[model samples]
Target: MTKGGMESVELFTSEGKGRGLKAQKEFLPGDVIFAEPAYAAVVFDRTSTWATTTPWGATDLGRCGWKAAIQRGTWGCWLAVADQEPAVPRGAREPMASWLGLEREGSGLAEGCLVSIDDLQNHVESFSEEEKKELRVDVESFLEFWPPQSQQFGIQFISHIFGVISCNGFTLSDQRGLQAVGVGIFPNLCQANHDCWPNCTVIFNNGNHEAVRSMFHTQMRIELRALSKISAGEELSVSYVDFLSLSEERRRQLRKQYYFDCTCEHCQKRIKDDLMLAVKAGESKPSAEAVKEVVQLSKDTLEKINKARMEGLYHEVVKLCRECLKKQEAVLGDTNIYLLRILSIASEVLSYLQMFEEAADYAKRMVDGYLKLYHPNNAQLGMAVMRAGVTHWHAGLIEAGHGLICKAYAILLITHGPSHPITKDLEVMRVQTEMELRMFQQNEFMYYKMREAALKNQKIHVMPEPSNETSPSLFHKKE
Candidate 1:
């Protein structure tokens, strides 16, 4: 596959997973796998009308609301307004209707709440009397603002949209990585299967400055990249759930939402390890009182650090983080989750303040901690390594920086691929560090040569004074 070009991948049937993309050729780490625009997207804002009354608090209800919003471009009372005046112009509505209808039909919705679209037709049919009654209230509240377009059609439409959103929506976050701003439906990205240890990741890019002037005016695209080296015929997978949690927790979450039992190699190993740990815990667990004390202390420290950060007291933030780290380390050691969390905070804050050396220290620690706890090719490890490399570079540790960057590049090449902005940024750093190292060596060599010549000239130009016994050479020459 060509660098920064189309990836060697194709869609195929994934075992256990309905459909998935597979690599068609060998992929190196940091290669761009593929880029695609979202099929449909909506920016999330808490202040929006639907945000006020939509039953999105419940997972199922939220999924339903997302689908309705995406499909009709409005929810609740707005749907009624659209029905009457048709907010979508005639020319636009036709195409939208065609797309939504096609998507809805193909979404595999079924009538039961078993997390599949295939059972959507029997959804109401299978509902218990209590469930049906509750659903009626939800549907009525959803339509409270809308004029009656057609009760039967509205009910069916809402149900189908709910199933589709539950199955397809992806959380959208802004560039800042602060919080999720919205949810979107990316048809192509939705095709990739789930793996506890995913080999690919999806990133969203909102267009340039002018484009971001208005939220609605901006165009967003989702990019998919290889997280690790994927051999030809290897299935490309992304994590659908947080993989940081233990295998049991991850499996439980996936089963609850996606309705699938994960039998992936990572999950299997984690499950086995967790079971073993549990057995050992029974034999040599810590004292309950001691554990409680440590937990409470950690919690209090974390709270204080968060408050300081919110108040923009960065110095306090760093100080608190360090204190927390010390306490956690003394009690739980470097690999403990709490210690790792504090280390991450310290690294980020220090980097933000341009304290590169200090940041590098914390980042290095984070990398080491992640390495000890996570898989070799884990995305978090890649991120920590990258941070360490960048900070080291900024701190003038050119060789260390270069080596760390290369290491990070190798790992990221497999997990994030080359086309990703992150990988691209790291490449820039790698080249820069290489150039800096060369210049530094050249300057050092020139300085040493100049010093050597200066010393030799001093020896040659200086004449030895006559010895005391021969000082009167002119008068004692005869003697």
Candidate 2:
């Protein structure tokens, strides 16, 4: 497959399934790996039309590949026949049916569509106990659609996703409802599912509006790899930070929907707690003190600590957080990602008290843990590094402080370009650092001048100010 000078991607499928991306060369942490405009993207909005029933009712549907794919899938729809050739008129009412085709300006726009081979690699699912309790249903929402040339156009429908998995991670969604016209690399970044402690990261480049770009030196084809250090045959991973779900809740959902039991360390630890909690609760028999104790220890204690922190009780927050860290570490281990967040907050309180040396040490430790777990370019990691650098400067380690500040500035530049709020902050910090250095130098110079004058026993005369009185007028008054 070829389109002009664009290298058309081919899916490396095995047993009717897509495999993960393989590295063509060694990639650096901040390197721009790959970027392709999304082949097809419909903004997830209230206006997205979904099928009331499967698409089998339409008779003219035999001409489209989408309809055939649906027939091959588990769900089926009735085929509807069009009395005349279907035309996509603007604002045409979407029929009271399920699944709609993309509207085209004309036949020319239709030819520009890019539906990749592995577009249907995975599906969305809702597996949380909370969600299940609310819906009491096993199924969750998903997107399906016809390509640009489908006959279902008279219906005027668009497909979309159900959750808020921030489209900021994708090259196509730099802005709301803005559509970019390139296809995603099939199963390259796709196989890497979401994680809080992802061993891999995706960097999109190549589009004019892309987040970051690394120019290629030679006329060579580029390949992609995990941005972070990974083992020889480790499973690829990416952060699902946009969801903000708890670890247990995320694992539950992933297991229910994705089908493969995630043996990721985070998931394993979460399942262990869940199993233990279940056993303890079962033994308590509703009125047991053990069950009540477990519940209070888990939720009530954390809630109280959170409330105290919110109410500005810094002392209580420090104490409770320390206690919580001890308990959590006993169960979750010191290396747990959540523990790093707790330590980071504690360092902030220390900084507020002007305990810069202690704060710097804690901030440094927090940053080290984050770098070990998360990709360096992540906003949180950048912030932690910035905090540690400032703390070191405040503690009077000028050289070490500047080094950390320089690193933080570089990371921020790569992760968040010049237009980002963090980049603006870094500029302010650079100016402030220079000002401090200049002031220190000026003070040293003045101190030496005063010392040399005193050692020489020299009388340094101060310049006199002009007298306020008019001497001529006073003498004339006497006359």
Candidate 3:
């Protein structure tokens, strides 16, 4: 129920959805709606044992694979320490437990400070009987490994804690971009609901460096920014899944993970449009084999390109990306998500190489894909436009360059704000393009004016003294 002192938003219960946040006042794009530190957070070691390779085999869990192991270890350690010490006041328990309702729900419990009966009931009701059974066993193992003095508080309590963590934990990444280093629960921030097309974005300000060596030393603060102009009383939402995904895929994901059906405007429109397009084209869905092939090709190609990038093989990266783009475009069409991703990479690599014409072409395609796939104020759109504009400028297409740059500036202003590094960079580009365009127009006008004057002078020179010529001609005719 915390508003975090943000005048623009307030806590409210969304219809059918539980408690959520809504706008209290109008918000312009890039406006900081609220910023808050996590009430309870755990920073884990970035190095995972699972990533280590041994003679037996390479064992690596996908992203955040080490989370469950870290959670179990922490719970075990907490229980062992509690057993040796006197019972502490409920208020003195870990900040996360209290913030997440574990303390209140587990009140009257003799041991296992993390256990919460009420929270467990709420959690279990959300899952099917089969899922509940599996969860019970998993919860029991964590508790049985490190039993508290009083065993009265059992698996149900442990299940609740796990449920809370699973549902609410936010992946804390290093400034190095999308690499998960830890997880934190910011209860106040989690009140915002999910929408397939979100109007706000979450940004973490950890530090100036692109990557931090240790999460323990990093101080992270989460900031919520308005992605577009939002009217008062509007719901504040952020996408939990990739917004670039198709409507059907997004809904399926939301149902599986968040346990809710999305009825967002984007979903409705996209579904309807897709159906209409299919009907008009008389096209049936692709076979599973074809779909599988495309997916595998996309994954394999992207992995190779990423490897080349990490190895600093820019030429290979560009060549691989171009080849992938051609295959993907033939199979997935220009607007497909996979093709868009390839275009983005190709555009960036070509621009870095100073191949302005090629870069501009790729960048323009990315802009088109983003426009079709992303929300109106999506930051990626602004970035794509900016890249295209810069390349166009370099290619000497002043009009197109200036126009696109201006468009990018408008979008970036709302998404990144005037003070952001990206906004500042775009502002500089916009100014440079403006000056260049002005100079171009001035030169063009002068050239036209000079040519007009030269033409008039030539005509006068060809006419020769009119009166003297007329008199000589008349005299010669008379003779």
Model 1 has a clash total of 29
- Where is the poorest 10-residue window by lDDT in model 1? 470-479
TM-score of each: 0.63, 0.46, 0.61
Instruction: Compare the candidates by TM-score and give the number of the best one.
Output: 1
Model 2 worst lDDT window (10 residues)? 470-479
The true-structure Cα RMSD of candidate 1 reads 19.7
RMSD list, candidates in order = 19.7, 20.1, 20.5
By lDDT, the better pick of 2 and 3 is 3
lDDT string, candidate 1, 57-168, tens digits: 2111121222233323221011111213213221121112223433444444322112233322223444447655655554555455333542335466664444444456
Model 3 Cα lDDT, one tens digit per residue, 175-249: 422345445555556677888778887656543433333323323466778887778899999877756667888
Highest-lDDT candidate: 3
lDDT of each: 0.55, 0.41, 0.57
- Reference-based lDDT, residue 74, model 3: 20
Q: Candidate 2: misplaced stretches above 4 Å?
A: 1-10, 14-27, 36-101, 104-118, 121-237, 241-253, 256-259, 263-301, 308-319, 322-339, 348-361, 371-379, 391-400, 410-479
Per-residue lDDT of candidate 2, residues 1-479 (tens digit): 00111122222332222354333344445434453333222211123221111233312222222232221111112122233333222121121112322122221222212232224332324334554332222111112233345543332112111111111113222211123211122223443455556654433223233221111111111123244644333444565342123457666655554444445566656533332233212332433464444345545555775676667786776676677655554444333445555666667766766667877877776776656554466644665687788888767655566667777887765554454445666767867766655655678666445545654695633222211211111000000
